[model samples]
Target: MRISVKLASICLMLVLLLTITTPAFAATTNPVLSVTGTTVAPVASVTPTTATAPLMPGDTGTVVVTLTNTLKSPGTGNTTVITESHQNVYPPTAGSGITTTRQTQTSSSDGSSGACELKFVNLLSEGPIHVQNAAYTDVGYLGLGDSAQFQFTIKVDDSAADGKYYLPLKVKTDNDECYVNQVVPVVIDSTQPRLVLNDAPSKLGTSRGNIIIDVVNYRSSGINSASVIPEGAEFTFKPRAEYTVGSIGAGEMYTVTFETSSKNATYTGNPSFVLKYKNGDNWHQTAPLVVGMEPKTDAAAAGNGGGDNTLLILGGVILVVLVLIGGVYLFMRSQRSKK
Candidate 1:
């Protein structure tokens, strides 16, 4: 009986000791092996970022990066604290509109030892172009069932050029980390249309002898004559009527004239004339007159010289005939008197 009592006491003592230490082991169901995180996008924000469009220049925008934990802790279950940080990855080239911003974790502490936790932050990066906001943080004090959520935002500048941009992000939990690679393309429009002149005028004048011209349309089906300058400058040829200039079909031509009084860059000789036709979106040029040139003369060439001699000779011949007739008449009169 004595031996049995001693053995019972020893068994009781051992049981009590085991129970005290066992609570700690029993408190934890499992041991946490690793930490992992993934982004949980709000149902409306499946893209993770606020917008997927290429960021506009001089514009402000936002993005959301989500992080999650992969492993659950053991024994004591997971009682862990988690934090998140953010960074920007600019385009590969310097001066690229692409840039980045680091978001400070807006919040991270929750007393609950549960499966869910989230961190929200505001991020900013300025300049024109495309860039990204990456939530990079790790699971801290991971015991059992440790997890975290990281959310951040970013902005793109309005002066950014158009092209393809790349945004790379990374996610971290405790000691483990993962990389996220994304590409965002930015497009820019900076080209202007060109306007060229098909025909140019070299002179401007009032007379027909200087320049004669045939003008035509340059770019489209027509041009506006209302833009004609120096209004009412004695136009010999009708530009609007002849060319249908307001509707000057492409490749169509019209005629105009220049007077003899026109001048060249070097000479103002009245012997020549020039016609100028300037047409353009900016209305910027003059063409040389293609008209024929001719010399001018007045009425002084007639009414003088050798014509007086011929009149005198004809008058003398008529006088001789009259004298002969008169003598015959006198002879007849004497015969009659003698008889």
Candidate 2:
């Protein structure tokens, strides 16, 4: 009986020892993975820096995005983050105006057994704007106090008008479920100068004369280095071939006078008026304008000179007949006095 009691006591002691040592071994081998007191709260943000300025048609630009993780400890494995963007219509470089949509992903963490993530950002344009590459970019991995940057290539639709576009972006993390949304503005500066003829003379004489022509700027922007030139072979100008107009503003007008004459002998028609101006760094010309013209002609040579010569000859003949009659009368008077 004593032997049986001894064996039972030994078994009980062994069981207790195993229980205490097993936990200690486990504590040493595998560290606690979960954050003790503070949870991993990651923070993220996005910036559309390119939107501050304007983009012209066929212009290529970039939009930047930044992400940061504020986690206290590394808890999980790799976290997936996605960034997505969409626009109402594609750029003009594309065949036609179509919808643009894109997505990208990244894995970010706090390092040392932590996870990292990236998310999609939605962007839209009021005008026709498109994304060339994927709308979103992958940052790969991000650690604690670590920041990641992504760049997106965007194109302004070639057919987009001069205007502003509002694009909103959404950022999210797959692991933490954290999200942020931001809106950025993009301006389009691809407006061409519009020139129109205003307050122009209805008629211009073919003789060497000066006439005023008003060049109107009908566009929303200003026209610089403007000039007007007559575009007809039948007309010539004095002082200069082209008249200088300088600059004109939207809804404003500038007038210039050109000394012009007809190159032809006799002609009556309009003279073409062309507007040349500078827009941005390029020069442009407008459609030809036709003005009324009455060319000089020799009316006297046509018939009036011959009619006057005939009248003069008839008068000379009548005067000579009167002179002869007077002479004969005087002779008869003298002869009678002598008798």
Candidate 3:
């Protein structure tokens, strides 16, 4: 009977030890306790909603980009995936202190990967507004539950045609093959005429010279009565003050000649031509096209030379008179000495 009781006591100790250790084994074996959260792909969206345009060529402006993170549960382990997915995402999170590289936008239409890409770059001191093989500015690091608005500086190509043109914006993450191509509207000012100083004479003749003026109508509509107002006191033209040109077609060149003359011998000033043109019954005038006029005349130099010649002639007469007086005195002295 005593042996049986000892066996029972051993069994009871085994049961107590199992009760304490069983909870620990269950905690280690249960997979739910090990994994605290779930991980999924990064969910984010970038939209270029509004664009401001009608900007002049050779001018710079800004484009706004809206970024939002739509991820419900962003995973810790997938942070790298999220960040790498938005490698081209721009204007990194505040204080994240991340720097990104400038990239070019490529067109699948042509096989030239980044060569002919249209991209926006920092404006250099001297260069074309649109850099070759580059497209839009990259805004880096768009994160979950975060919204960012980024302003991108862009330049309109000087040679870009009037009317609305769209610049393609491409956003992609290196981690995935997904990319978004958003087109932004760019409008070039179509109403203004580009008045370029095509040609001019180096020197205006004393009486008259031909001032060649070119009216380049780059607008869609033609211009009428394209004229130049040569307004200055020092100069005069055939017509009182205005030189009228008939009409100029769109994208056409009209060369008008003005018979300009300088009034004074010594005139050193800019002879300005105010460009006046009419478009659809509305008159428009451009800033003065000031041409440097330095009147060329030998008359001024000849007048000074004539004064010198007069003084020389007077000197020659006095010299002749003095020689005669000396000769007479010498003859009188010779006669006195002989007597």
Best by lDDT: 2
Off by over 4 Å in 1: 1-4, 7-17, 20-52, 55-115, 120-127, 130-159, 167-339
Query: Residue 47's C-alpha lDDT in candidate 3?
Result: 24
Tens-digit per-residue lDDT, 49-70, candidate 2: 3223345565655555555665
List residue ranges in candidate 3 displaced over 4 A.
1-191, 194-201, 295-339
lDDT of 3: 0.52
Q: Sort by TM-score, best first: what order?
A: 2, 3, 1
Kindly list the per-residue Cα lDDT of model 3 for residues 130-180, writing each as its tens digit: 423333355454443445454455565666666665555545443232244
What is each predicted model's overall lDDT from 0 to 1? 0.35, 0.55, 0.52
Backbone atom clashes (below 3 Å) for every candidate? 44, 17, 9
Tell me how far the alpha carbon of residue 224 in candidate 2 is from the true structure, in angstroms, after superposition: 2.1
Q: Is candidate 1 or candidate 2 better by lDDT?
A: 2
